[model samples]
Each structure stands twice: as structure tokens, then as C-alpha cells.
Target: MPVLAGAEPFSHTASTEVGVLLCHGFTGSPASMRPWGRYLADLGHTVRCPRLPGHGTTWQECNRTRWTNWYDCVHTEFETLARSCESVFVFGLSMGGTLSLRLAQQLGDAVAGLALVNPSVLTLRKDARLLPVLGRVLPSVKGVGGDIAKPGVIEPAYARTPVRAAASLSRLWKLVREDLYKVTQPMLLMHSVVDHVVEPVNSRVIAEGVRSTQLTEVLLYDSYHVATLDNDAPLIFERSAEFVRSVRQVAA
Candidate 1:
């Protein structure tokens, strides 16, 4: 499948021993994370942003993939970074955040730290409970993309929500929530105070559930769900870089 413009995965090889893996949200392509990756790379940190399977293409194709496919893609990228760097920090937005948390849980100290933006584990939508059944009859619904508060900034995401893929994501959410206690690494969590796609309670759930002793939470007042590309993006980038440096220094 031909990937969309600006949606291609990106990687930067730096001389530094520290690396950062960036994961974009469900249905969102690497375009959403490209700037952040560039910022880290400019700071001489090895960086990667992989395009999850079923993304960066048609939503119909996305419907054919499962959450495991996305997770596996991220896992491969992390392994690639781990092979070349002494320490690897995982950063994610939305569902990418969920996958990052799972990595920290399953990989343990292999993940030096985590920086999450609007990571989602739960949703309050009453209809979400019926996704398992609805997916059988429905192929898709309205998209949840382009929720950025910054005017004129657009996220390269699917125009429709793939029901089957979304159903698979819900299952992944349950698993991540169950294993939150295993995520013991230091974490930097940032969320939009006025996000329309993911509720603030989602971040609260993670903050309360994670076993990390060092947890920093910042609320984005100017951005929406996709804060990485919104008005508060620079703040997210700066804070994440600082967080990675602090964690890597401690690890050293």
C-alpha cells in the first residue's frame, strides 16, 4: 500500500548513547510525531517514530489489522534502538502511550523511562461497550482526528474510525490497565486539560495505577487531544527532553 504523504516512519542516528522511541496514536501517522522526533534528533539523541501497521494508509486496511500488529511494530523499533544505544526512552501520544506503558511493563528496565501525552486506557462513551458486537455489522464511523486546538494544524489520521481495529484497541487497553503495576520506570505524563477526544480521567487512571516512584504530570491548557502538534507542543518537547536527560543521568 502506498503510504500517505508526510506519514512515513522516521529515524535519526545520533552519536549519543541515549535513544528515544516515539509512537503515534491509533489511526494517526508519523506526521503527528515528526516534529517531536526532529527536536530530539537535533539535540543529538537517537530517535525513531515508526508507522504502526494498518496506519499511514487507507482506513479500510486499518480495519484488517489488530492491536498486536501495532504493538509488534513498536517493539521492533524499540529493539532496534536498544541494540545501538545504552539507554532508550519511550515516548508516545494517545494509544501510542498505551503501547509505551505496556513496553515498560513487559521489558522492565530495558525502557529507561516513559513520556506520554494523552495516553488512553479507558473511555466513558456508553457505546464503546458494544464495539465487539458492532464491529461485526459496521465497518466504520466518524473519525476522531483533527482535535488540535491550534488553528490550521492538521493531524494526518484516518477520516473514519475502523470498528474492528477500535475493538482490538479496547482489548489492549484492558490488558495495559491490568499490568500498570509492572511499569516501575520514571514517567513524564502530559495531557490536555481541554482534550475532546480523550478525557482527562484517562491520565488520572494511569497516574494512580502506575508503580513509578517518579511521576511528573503536566496539564496542557492550550492544546486539545493531539497536543504534540498543538499550541503546547514546544512545552511537551522541552519537558520530555529534560525528563529523558534526568532519567538517563540517573541511570548512568
Candidate 2:
């Protein structure tokens, strides 16, 4: 929460009837979710998107953290939102989605539902990740600092990819694959069938693995990895809003 994905502060302690905790992908910051958060905030729901430690900073800083630290960050946000809202729904992008799924498994009925965009869980194309030598010798990329990239669109905040962090992801995902059955909360997952990052099969796996009968997968036909900023971002946002409404209806 300290280096909150680059925004520099938390939401004012204002209360709302409904709340959402947004989580960004691995090596990414809350900036990935800021647009979505702002949109949801306009809906009169309190939204918190905390930056994972070592993110929105240097990739070397991120290299020092692991998936557990990332989960801890979002879990704190989740608990904080739970204390002040009547209902809590989680939305996450990429690895952020993986954390959301894990939390839903942990919270069960306590978490109303989830929305995932281009989730990272089964997205890896084999054991391939960042090239170790380059990650070790080369400096962070000049742009989004290990951040998410929307297809054909580029983010200046994104920098270098952290190999150490990715190594951790490779291991953490295996654990998630075995535990997917524990996520039974109603979920609406969105992914691009042609995503260059996470494979479309990842979303399919989520829709099939989670026990929730309300789970659905929305495909972004015109987007790539970072659907959040691509041409289909509007569709992702609307579909996500609808998912929250559907879950809230069920919870009500």
C-alpha cells in the first residue's frame, strides 16, 4: 500500500454500500487497474487498488518480492474493504486475477464474486519466461517497468521484466492449478482469444475449474494481452460491471 501502484495515496476513508478491491498483475502496479477503479468509483462504490510492493518502482525492487507478498498486499486491501462495505466483489487483471481467485477460495461466501481480465494462471507457454541472462544483465525496459501492455498500444510506465519475479510465478501457478477447485464464488472471467500474453485456455480453465455455477467467460475479439487499454476495454468494463451486478443480485 505504500507505493500504491504510483498514485501515492489511498482512498479517503469514505464509506460506501458496495466496495471493490482491484489487483493488478505481477510486476505491475495499481495503474493497471486505475482506470477501472475510477470507473467503479463513479458508480458510487468505494474502490481500492493497492500497489504490490516493489511495483511502480524499479524491477530490481520487485525482484526482491514474491507472489506471497503480492497476495498479502491484496489480502490487506480485501480485509480493509470487507470491514466497511455491505458487499465485496474482487476484480483483478493478469496475476492479479490469480490472487483474486485465491482469495475467493479463502473467503467463500464472504466474497460475493470476482471479475478477471486476461488472468495469468494457465497463461504461460510452457516453462518459458524472461530470458535469464538478459534479465540479469540488461536494465529494466524503457517503458512500463514490467507492466502490462495493451495490444499495439504502449505504456510509458512499464519498464523492464523481472526474471526473478517470473521464476516465482512459474512455481506459484502450479500450486494454483491444483487448488482451483477451492474457488467457488460466482465469477465472470474475460480474456482475448488471441491474447499474446496469457493464453485463452487460461480463462477456459478458470471457467471450468471453479465450482461456481455462475462462472462465465467473455472473449475480447479485438484485443491482445493488455485488454484493459485495448479497443475492447469498454466491453471488458461493461461486462465486468454486469458481472458485479449479477453477483450482487444473487447475494441480495
Candidate 3:
């Protein structure tokens, strides 16, 4: 399948012995993560952002894939980074954060640290409970993309949310929540104070559930769900870089 323009995966190799793997959100392409990857790369960190399976193409095609496929893609990328770098950190936005958490849980200390932006583990929407039933009858619904507060900045995401894929995502959320205690690595979590797509409670759940003693939480007042591309983007980039450096120092 031909990927949409600006949705191709991004990779940068650097002399730094640190590797950072970025994961984009559900229905969002690598375009949403490219700038962040570039920022890290410019700072001498090796970076990669993989296009999740069933993403970067039409939403209709996304419906044909399951959450496991997306997780597998992220796992592969992390392994590649681990092979070449002395320390590998995982960074993710939205559902990508969920995948990153799962990776940390399964791989344990293999992941140096985690930096998550508006990661979703639960949704307060009452209609979300009907996804299992609705997925059987409906192909898709309205998209949840482009919730950026910054005007004229668009996220390269699907115009519609695929029903089946979303249903599978719900299952993934349940599993991740159950294993939250297994995530003991250091973490930095950033969330928008005014996000319209994911509720703030999702981040709260993660903060309360994780066993990480080195957790840092930052609230973003200027951006929405896609804060990585919004007004507080610089904050996200700088703070994450600092977090990584701090972790490296601790390891040393």
C-alpha cells in the first residue's frame, strides 16, 4: 500500500549511544512525530518513528488490522534500537503511549525510560462502551484527529475512526491497565490541560498506577491532544531531552 505524503516512517542515525523510538497515535501518521524525532536527532540522539500497521494509509484499510499488529510494529522498532544503542528510550503520543507502556512492562529494564504525551488508557465517553456492538454494524465514525489548538497546523490522520480497529484498541487498553504495575522504569508524562479528544483522567490513571519512582508529570496549558505539534511543543522536546539526560546520568 502506498503511504500518504508526509506519512512515511522517519529515521536518523547519530553518533550518540542513546536511541529514542517514537510512536505516533492511533490513526495518526509519522508526520505527527517527525519534528520531535528531528529535534532529538539534532541533539545527537539516534531516533526512529515507525508507521504503525494499518496507519499512514486509508482509514478503510486501518479497519482491517488489529491492535496486536500495531504493538508488533513498535516492538520490532524497539529491538532494532536496543541492538545498536547502549540505552533505548521510548516516546509516544496517545495510543502510542499505550504501546510504549506495554513494551516497558514486557521488556522491563531493557527500556531505559519512557516519555509519553497524552497517553490514553481509558475513555470516559459513555458511547465508547458500544464500540464492540457498533463495530459490527458501522464501518467508521467521525474522526478524532486534528484537535490541535494551534491554528492551521493539521495532523496527518484519518478523516474517520475505524470501528473495528477502535474496538481492538479498547481491549489493548484493558490489558495495559492490568499490567500497569509491571512498568517500573523511569517515566515523564505530559498532557494537555484542555484536550478535547482524550480525557485528562487517562493520564491520571497512569500516574497513579505505574510503579516508577522517577515519574515526572507536566501539564500543558497551551496545546490540545497533539501537543507535540502545538504551542508547547518546545516544552515537550526540551523537557524530554532533559529527562533522558537525567536518566543517563543516573545509569552512569
Best lDDT among the predictions, by candidate number: 3
- The list of candidate 2 runs beyond 4 A from truth reads 1-15, 127-153
* lDDT against the true structure, each candidate: 0.95, 0.74, 0.96
lDDT of 1 at 30: 94
The residue-by-residue lDDT of candidate 1 on 95-148, one tens digit each, is 999999999989999999999999999999999999999999999999999899
Tens digits of per-residue lDDT for model 2, 21-108:
8888766666657678777877778888887777777677877788888888888988999999988889988888888888887778
Candidate 3 or 1, higher lDDT: 3
How many clashing pairs in candidate 2? 9
State TM-scores per candidate: 0.99, 0.86, 0.99
Model 2 scores a C-alpha lDDT of 0.74
Question: Model 1: how far is 127 from its true place, Å?
Answer: 0.2
Off by over 4 Å in 3: none
Q: Clashing pairs in model 1?
A: none
RMSD of candidates 1 onward, in order:
0.7, 3.4, 0.6
- Whichever of 1 and 2 has more lDDT, that candidate is 1
Better of 1 and 2 by TM-score: 1
lDDT of 3 by residue, 126-182 (tens): 999999999999999999999999999999999999999999999999999999999
**Is 2 or 3 the stronger prediction by TM-score?**
3
Q: After superposition, how far is residue 158 of candidate 1 from its true place, in Å?
A: 0.9
